[model samples]
Target: MAFACQRDSYAREFSTVVASCSPAEVKTDVNGKKGILKGFHVVLKDTLLFPEGGGQPDDRGFLNDIPVLQVTRQGPDAVHFVQMPLNLDSEVHVTLDWGRRFDHMQQHSGQHLITAIADLMFGFKTTSWELGRQRSTIELDTPEVIPEQVEAIEQTVNEKIRQHIPVIVRVVSVDDPEVEKVRSRGLPDDHAGPVRIIDIEGIDANMCCGTHVSNLSHLQVIKILGTEKGKKNKTNLLFLAGNRVLKYVERSYTVEKALTSLLKNGPDEHVEAVEKMQKSVKLLQKTNLNLLRDLAVLTAQNFKSRADRGPLFSLHRKDGDNEFMNIVTSEIGTEETLIFLTVGDEKTSGLFLLAGPSELVEKLGPRVAELLEGKGAGKRGRFQGKANRMSRRPEVEVLLREALAGWQPTEE
Candidate 1:
């Protein structure tokens, strides 16, 4: 028994013959929801599973109670993917996943209604549409959609949906005169034989090959989320229909409640409270930096002299950064001084700086970095970079001190 599901989309259950069943593996990420999964490919003589097309996803259901992972179309074949292959020439019972199918139908039908309104009222034709897992979008030819126009579209679409209009689906010959009366951009270049048109009460009758419910009222409601700038001069209108709208509302309410509790403010005051906290955080950061700068200079000035070490200067401290090192170097007055500063805490790496006369700095800077098992670069006066070995801080100080202890600077 090979039932033509496309001829009667509302048929949830049907009988079909497994024309050919082949064990083939399909590797897919399932749209980032998971890693690659493997499945088998089985083609049916006739199937109710709409093999993913017209911007709608593949129908998921069962063939003889075994899960049908997905359905796809190849040329004139409806191919079903499953975990286990069915027997060739078997009479299988096909059942569509009612909820998933209904959701796709509602959103796909809503798109047609919305597209018709956009084209009829604003002369902005729909170039494309996508039925995403959580939301749907229609790309319009216009560069932008004004706020008023969007509100108008929502109002009109919902009104028609509330009218409980019977959705009329009819197939006609390719050269039928009725196709000319239908508001279609045109049939596809490769379209052959008959044309399928979905007529919405008095609003629209457009060419579509996707499954839809029997009536517009099944859409329940249509909510336009917003508009986004799309390719070149196009605008993508995001929307939700039926249960998707309900899910979006539920998620938004949950987030809003969390923010209200965390901010200790009502919904109306969330923006003001967050802005005030941000300003206070910025002010505190500024104040703390100024204090650290002063302490770095004081710490540098307190270091004592070194005998026969040729003006060697070294300082090691906790919580020190590049800015702290720069401040200390600036405080130590000129004197052909060879300065080294290594700073870190107990559990992490630190940074090192070597500064002195051009000849000594060039000779000793890279050597100090190497002694600490790190890399650095400098030529004229100062060399600075991070060192991954914090325990090697003392080794860095000793290497520079001993190197300078034997150094003699060239004439300026």
Candidate 2:
């Protein structure tokens, strides 16, 4: 999140003072009660400690042994909170956790680099940004960015990182006539203080209050993870930078090496190995289909041989896949024998009941479904239902026959 400092009549003087206080510490109250002496004071980036405004988390660190519970913006100055109270004139050394601060800087600086490169290379202007814990995202003005364009932009960002460009922070009065000429996305108009601007030398400049690295080279690398389409022509870019990028690379390499060993190939041959595996899977699927067709034929013949004089009924009991049940319902079901098949997996089960005499089956289908604690309807004589629990095959068959016997043809 970025904030525009309200420039007052003494804006120039404030800029000079704040610039000098690049890292300043002041006495503050702790525990939000009486003003007792606390351990030490802390310096915070003006934008870093905003408890309000944008929904960004506050910066937290320790001041000597005392913990800085929260960093928040109080008007123009950022207030740092501690567990213990502070005295009126207590003196303590203030230090900003350089590691945490540098991480934020690298992320912010990398965002500028990528956004700027995207604008220059692809004409995709960044509309807004969200800084998150693991990944930060920049929303672009356009909805669709081609994959190739993203790859190119990523390359450019890293190329710039390698160039080691200077990331300079400047504080200029909002009233400075030159300020209007500069293009910035989010600049607060009613600000009474000098605006802090981040300048990536030879690349981009924008009004931003977020802390940034002194140089782009410190970023090391910028990794574009992925992009998502947003409402009204916007693309959200997820990216990582600096140590985060290194961590991602290390983890990814580990996974790749494991996959290579499993596939018995080098990193370059992994793609080919996966493709071959996919082809093998397809062949196995074809063989399975053939076996299912053969089984359906044998089952149909067996049902025909056991045909009863009244109503030839055949119940094929099998706990198998849905596709096989569908094939059985389509192929074995006929006018002579009504087929009732039950399929079950580890978690749930399903039933497919098909019969001839379209009218009888249609009328009894819903009742049969109800008996099995399921619900289904169908045209012609075929019906299917998904059961919430495993149902006894005999009970279902009996209820189905009873329903069929009770069913009466109705005038359409």
Candidate 3:
């Protein structure tokens, strides 16, 4: 038997007796976190809530004011999951979320119209379809759908909608000869009762279990967004129907307005303006890199000119990169003085390099990295790595000074 929801898609309320209610646990994800949800699975003698099946998500509604989290089809029964349980055989008021159900109807019916038109006009068979939150897609048997074909299909579908073609629902026996005339992928393994066929006037008849609009005009309009490459020599066509298209347009216009204000250019000129800004940024980056290189060399020279300096010397530059640190080390000659160079913020994270005597560098490099909350490796009198605590640079200097105080340059 067809559920009450399948019989009347327009109905929002139904009074049904609870057949059974059992404790149940469901797994769900909220805001990206997965957890187990404790609930009760309640079955009604008849319900207006559609179960999750046939590519359409389950309907969300209320059973006597308690929120229905999910509904699933178990064989011929519609199982409603809720937080509280109801007494068996008790009469309960069921309320369907009209907004959600209506939106789903528009998209599902739009897919049917598009599928029928594509097959009739271009011989493109719909292999599969998905009604998503914001948009819907239909996978065609062909490898590709050209722009012209999409336009034609979209135009024909909208025309049919404007014509207000009747969408009739017919329930036929499983062994009925009329079932052979309708398009079907066969029945589900646990499917029982008669089969329901959705007939679109003289256009097409398809066997489906999902709820759909009663009239083609209810679809309002359908916009074919575009097509994408699909697996196994197929094409996935994206589309928006009814209020979805309107919402998409509203969001798009809001974004365009915000960009216009920030870019100081109209929507038509925004792309060109962004391209020019990108070029200017690249040029500035190149100029900044050249300046840093020169600054590194000057910094090395300044350090070398310090006659009264000790065996350990340290320097920090917030704008410096790996190349800058390396250039400074190369110019300073780490043979006599142990060079400690860092590039980045002093209070935050950055890179550090310790270069000097091979043995001292190998021993002290690890300690310096530990103090700065980092890891590094070294060989041939050079150790370099990233550090997360550049604020501890002074602590690292003290450790290096104490180690160098008892040290003397070995005669080579």
Task: Please tell me which predicted candidate would have the highest TM-score against the true structure.
Answer: 3
Candidate 2 lDDT by residue in tens digits, 171-261: 8877887677555855655455777767899888777666667788889888899899977879998999899888788888999989988
Better structure of 2 and 3 per lDDT: 3
List where candidate 1 sits over 4 angstroms from the true fold. 1-5, 8-10, 23-27, 30-38, 185-193, 291-412
Deviating ranges (above 4 Å) for candidate 3: 308-412
Q: Which regions of candidate 2 deviate over 4 angstroms?
A: 1-104, 118-124, 127-164, 188-194, 224-239, 307-323, 334-336, 354-364, 367-375, 391-395, 401-412
Candidate 3 weakest ten by summed lDDT = 403-412
lDDT of 3 by residue, 243-308 (tens): 998999999999999999999988999999999999999999999999999999998899889888
RMSD, candidate 1, Å: 5.0
**Candidate 3 global CA lDDT score:** 0.93
Clashing pairs in 1: none
State the lDDT of candidate 1 residue by residue for 1-412, as single tens digits.
2126557777889887889887676766765765556767899888888888778888989999999987877766778888887888999998988889889999999999999888888898999999998999999999999999999999999998889999888888878888888877666564555788888878889877788878989899999999999998999999999889988999999999999999988999989999999999999988888988989878766753434544877777777778988888877743567888877863357788887787778787887887677778876688987777767667767777787778876756
Poorest 10 consecutive residues of model 1 by lDDT?
Answer: 301-310
For each candidate, what TM-score against the reference?
0.76, 0.65, 0.85
TM-score of candidate 1 versus the correct structure, residues matched by position: 0.76
